[model samples]
Target: MIFTGSLNAQGFEGWFNKYLLPSLTRASVLIMDNAPIHRKSAISQLVEHTEHQIVFLPKYSPDLNDIEHDFSALKRKRMYASSDTSLDDIIRDYCIT
Candidate 1:
């Protein structure tokens, strides 16, 4: 689930608990960027008690992440779209294929 509120550590913790934890089926590695929220003490403790592992990307190396390319492609597709376009419509159009 996409969280639409604060992007702080607390928000991340809630999202991790409500969404991520329940989706896992077995021990796995989760790769994430070096964001402060991802490295919070609460998140560390949570992960330590779970059957999952969290690995952070090297700092200053966003180019190694593929999500950036996905977002860039999405932005490029909507470059000429009207500013009034609804987000739902945009998501449907971009993701429906």
Candidate 2:
């Protein structure tokens, strides 16, 4: 996994080169939401040079995104783990680790 202090275009580009590109076994279709960072021109150029193709999801369709479901399950588990803890506290605990 790639870790970074931010989630902007630069951070994503770094992750793509350092982690995603090297992990690929074959040309793949990458499905992504239409976030501005994913739409960056430099990111498109980078993808064009790689063996992967990106396909953006339709707008406002979280139900169609598998990662969204994973996050929802994780949120539920975290909430259950510390029902009495404040959200900020739980988030801080996670971020610090």
Candidate 3:
């Protein structure tokens, strides 16, 4: 979640190194957006250590990321076009996903 400021680089690194890496015996390729944090050296190291490759999606092209559509669908179907007035509301919306 990038809501704090920037994306969670170290957290992403941990997820990759500790969990996503060991998730599969073979190398896996990760497709991602071209966020500055995603291109940082630490994340690069994590990708290398995990034997997974990050294939960044083109800038300004959320259509290329499959999750974008899913998120839109979730917002449309569950949120009922309501503004996320609180953390609870946001969490409840995501639960419907």
Candidate 4:
């Protein structure tokens, strides 16, 4: 989902319930960075109620999180995009491939 503003706990919770939770076909370990939204009790409660688990990465360890690399690459690729290029197209071409 492309969100225009910062993601708050409520937004994350909604996305978790609507998308992430349903996508888990089996019990899985979800590794997350130490973002404040990820620490919300409601999100934790939801995850705990399911077979999936959430593991927070150690503080200040971006290298340990794979998505950071993807974000970096996305930013780099976005720099080269023409003014008319859409974010969805950039992501599809540079990230999703």
- Identify the candidate with maximal lDDT: 4
For model 2, the stretches where C-alpha displacement exceeds 4 angstroms are 2-5, 61-97
- Compared with the true structure, model 3 gives a TM-score of 0.43
lDDT for each of the candidates? 0.78, 0.75, 0.67, 0.84
Model 3: colliding residue pairs:
none
**Pairs of residues clashing in candidate 1:** none
Measured with C-alpha atoms, the lDDT of residue 84 in candidate 1 is 90
Local distance difference test, candidate 2: 0.75
lDDT of 4 by residue, 1-97 (tens): 6779889878888898899899989999988887888864676788988999888777886798899999999998889889899989999897558
Which scores higher on TM-score, 1 or 4?
4
Expressed as tens digits, the lDDT of each residue in 17-40 for candidate 1 is: 888888999998988787888864
lDDT of 1 at 82: 90
Stretches off by above 4 angstroms in model 1 are 61-97
lDDT preference between candidates 2 and 3, better one: 2
Candidate 4, residue 86: how far the Cα is off, in Å: 39
What's the true lDDT of residue 38 in model 3? 73
Per-model TM values vs. the true structure: 0.52, 0.50, 0.43, 0.54
Error of 3 at 56 (Å): 1.3
To one decimal, what is the Cα RMSD in angstroms of model 4 from the true structure? 10.0
Candidate 4, which ten residues in sequence have the lowest lDDT sum? 34-43
